[model samples]
Target: MDRRVLFATLILLAGGATGVGVALFAFVGVDDATTETTVVWESEPAAGDDGSGAAVATVDGDPLLLRPAVENGSRVVRATVAGGDETTWTVPISGPDAERGGGDANGSDGDPSGVSGLTTGTLGGDPVAALTTAPGELVVVDAADGTERFAVDIGGPGGLRPAIGDLTGDGTPEVAAVGTDGSVRVVDGEGDSVTEASLSGDIDRRPLVVEPDAEAGERGGIAVMTTTGDPATVHLLDETGEARWTTTPNVNPYSWNAADSRDGSVLVLGGTSGNIEAVETGDGSDRYEVGLQDLPVEVGDADPGTVYVGGSGSVWAVDLLDGEVVWKQQYGASTRINEPGVGDTDGDGELAPVVVNRAGEVLAMTQRGKVTARGGPDAVVYGGPLFADVTGDGGDEVIVVADDGTAIAADT
Candidate 1:
């Protein structure tokens, strides 16, 4: 199916580890190398109380506003829609130290209490969709949003754009953004700049991906990507901004995607290997592996310990502790899912991989829609299941983009 997940789309599932035993796509047999299945899923309406709609926004006719942006001092700044109106709103990101860094997000060192004039932009051509942060500074506002929430100039003298990840596992996330000048910067949670490493003299180079280690002590560990001639190099960085480990493509790494298991193990996509590779988060050593005959469309971990793979119109669950296969499901053949993002949908006390499909029931103008709800096939239908209540409530609510360009919310 032309709908097979594509690497050019940057599909990434951000959690867990596991080996194979179960198959992900119904047709792919666990023991048969030639086995291939066409897995598809039923589409359901976006979850909400009345189905009238949830929160929504749009740039032109996009149907959804940019991803939610978390301002350092302000809560979560999301593009919101209500009663046929669209504008951004500040939903309090409640928690301890929520307002640690406040200033012009541009690093103007403006104010240290709050941010203002929040706006939007683009990163490496990818739309700066959203932003978030851990406990301290190292603010990660949507570079797309020009607002200053703990603004501190990054990327040498020209400033820079950064990607944020929970590198230290301190329960707090850090800024692991690549500089526009080809440097990598690691900043404190408080927006205080830390170490900046020169990536190479090539200004046109971009760090394909940056992810934190899952191991408790390896919280500050990071994984990065760079290009050499035509070959791409992937490097693992420690909390100290040192290159702890690096690797080259065995074949042709199409798109760079990385995620971590609870034990600090990492899974990387887009290597010459043509299969997903697992590596030690601490030293970036080779670990177990899995091969998706078709390039891995997307990868995610459900409970912080198992890795999930979606491709060839199916899903595969792998164990992180030992790389065992848990289960596999082939939902649809023609409906390929993209942007394999994960978060708990049913609020069943666990987060699962969520995807946008165009086959069975869920219908977005683009198969790149969204799936909320959890469980194998019986999970309760909830609204857009993105992240945890990241807002403040004990549980997270569903957020979805209605076809009419409005944001909708429903308690799960």
Candidate 2:
């Protein structure tokens, strides 16, 4: 997906609201609560390491998406937040002297040059934005003026945005990031010290912010991937960065996108083990498993009982309710898919699954995965297709990011 759209998807789960309901479904879905998420307090997921990867949660209320881009020679946060007045802010991507929650920013650590991830959430009762920059730096910005507040020196650079939440049930939000060394670091919005917790394996993707449900009361924890064994492990960290429970599911999870089921009981997640499966979110137990005709790249739910999965050259609809293959269609477009957009691209009032390929191709398909509209650019697409009414012409447009960092909106 365009780095910005990817950030939006990945960052929306920053506050530990819930697993990306869609991805947990396939890669990331918007239905965490409905699927019945489990906190995984003490058990280890069943084990089997075969795995690959997937998408993130895109914010729904943001007026415009902000992507970090280049301007002149420095890195800038490019924003389309305003309808017309597009804005750019030059980020201080140099140096590592800002204090972290527990340490001073030292420039001698990891690559901390360019900004890679951008996400915003409320911290200390104020609007706060965070970026994971190259050379190992976590810079917290005040969204009001883009002022640099916290610049901590981490050792490795990752594009995963920090997940923010009230991890301690202290009525304030805290930001959590997976350390390059397989550790979880959490810093309160107002503190200067971090609560670092180590996991069993290396941290694979960004940690997921799981929200509290009726079953639990203190607060939900962060769901992080620690791939040490073959099937890998999913560790549930409580508010204080303590491991509450760990489980190894049947498949090794690759993509961070996990969608919640409609009943809010399970998560649909991508398994590199050549299968798409559902697991109990709270305990990491396998609920169901299904084979895949192609490697899945994007996953979501069209409706209850129906899950939409986009792969390298095909899309499949799995009937989790009945454990049957609803429909699977192949469209030889490219190698992988960005997040799929489900909307009425045909202007027929019927929703179609729109997928953007790495080749800059957009395909609008029917509910049964039948192709409808196909259009895109000549260059490589850097992000997934975003379905929006950019022109306000009563028609939806497929917006994609080019490899050159340009947002290209194509009409369906």
Candidate 3:
């Protein structure tokens, strides 16, 4: 997906809200509240080792805090509510392990409904915009002119921001937004209008957005995954808001997270079947699948090229041209990494580093945020070997949200 479209979709669906009813029933439909269960990973996630990373810096008045939601050999960090002169709530990450709360499809424990996961950061793009809070309350400004380009409100604290992309291949980017009520909204950038679809009841959490296929002279397509019961309902929606196909795959392995390469190849994370599968953008068919012992925390593709998969203190680089492992490295049997950012950090010829393995390898900002780099299996130099940027002034900066509501902009 284009970086711009990616960030826009994410911001629009930032908060978790109530659940709504939908007609698509692909997963195991759960009439009772979602059971909360603790997952015991055979292996634990390790914290990253620190190197001479970059410092934090700011562009306009708005500060940027670069905090990668490191993988969890340690514990899961729960976003906490920020108090005092703050508009947004900061999910707390201070516990020994990050907290995973089970709710209905919308991440709500069963109430009017609430926001699920809301974090501040950027995907892939120059001059990336950071989300202030969940979308229901916050509006995205141009930053340059502070012009209100978009205003978002989804009933309660709706923040299930959509993933931005050109699913229809229409140049005009669209956003896939989830409402506080389990309703999914596909907003067109050109029209600035929303087309919504809902199931019979609230679909647990927000729908996972994926561009399943792109046909020559054909409009692109999108996949929306919602909880049916134990299964996941994957709906294929075209740019015209028409449902073309639907699939109910048995994916009880892990919670679902997804990322796509530049060519539109899709990777589904956290499979219950203990594997990570890559699906072709052309068809929903599986390209390659890898066993995943640890929870699939985060997924990132390299500058529209390399496919970097990281988990349990290890990183693997996959070549998209052919579902082949470029290289896989173990930085340490013990360490933890967070939300990873991949791009061309150095002026080198190759694409940005797929995964940064070392702790200090990350480029740290003055504020102490990090930019990570790692070597691909087929790589020559220590791809990104390690570094960070603070200011984002021609360089990258780490945007870490402080314990308080204030966003910390560190130099990379």
TM-score (all chains, Cα) for each model:
0.54, 0.67, 0.55
Model 2 TM-score, all chains together: 0.67
Q: Compared with the true structure, what per-residue lDDT tens digits does model 2 show for residues 1-412?
A: 2221111211112113222122222222121122211111111110110000111112343334445544555555544532234443435456333222211011011222244445567786667677665445666776655567787754454445566766655567777776656756777775465567776666646676665555443346777777676677777777667777777765556444444444443555565544566765566666666656434445544554566766776666666543355555544444565546677655667667777666767766667554556656654553455555555556555556555444556665
- Highest lDDT scorer: 2
Candidate 3 has an lDDT of 0.36
- Cα lDDT for residue 120, candidate 2: 65
Model 3 per-residue lDDT tens digits across residues 1-412: 2221111111111012222111111111111222221111111111221111111212343432222133444311222111112212112222232222343232212211122232222222212221212334323323222233454443333434345565655455555655544555665543254556664334334444554344533345656655664466666566665666665553342334455465565545435333445555454665555443344433444445455555556554445444344444444354433324454343243345433332323321110111232212111111122222433244433233222212322232
Indicate whether candidate 1 or candidate 3 has the larger TM-score. 3
Runs of candidate 3 with Cα error greater than 4 angstroms are 1-139, 145-147, 152-157, 200-218, 253-264, 272-274, 294-297, 321-323, 354-394, 397-412
Which residues of candidate 2, in runs, are more than 4 Å off? Answer: 1-62, 81-85, 95-114, 120-129, 142-145, 149-157, 164-174, 188-195, 215-219, 294-307, 319-324, 341-352, 365-372, 387-389, 393-396
Candidate lDDT scores, in order, read: 0.40, 0.52, 0.36
Cα lDDT, model 2, residue 63? 31
Each prediction's number of clashing residue pairs: 76, 73, 112
Error of 2 at 337 (Å): 2.3
* lDDT-better candidate, 1 vs 3: 1
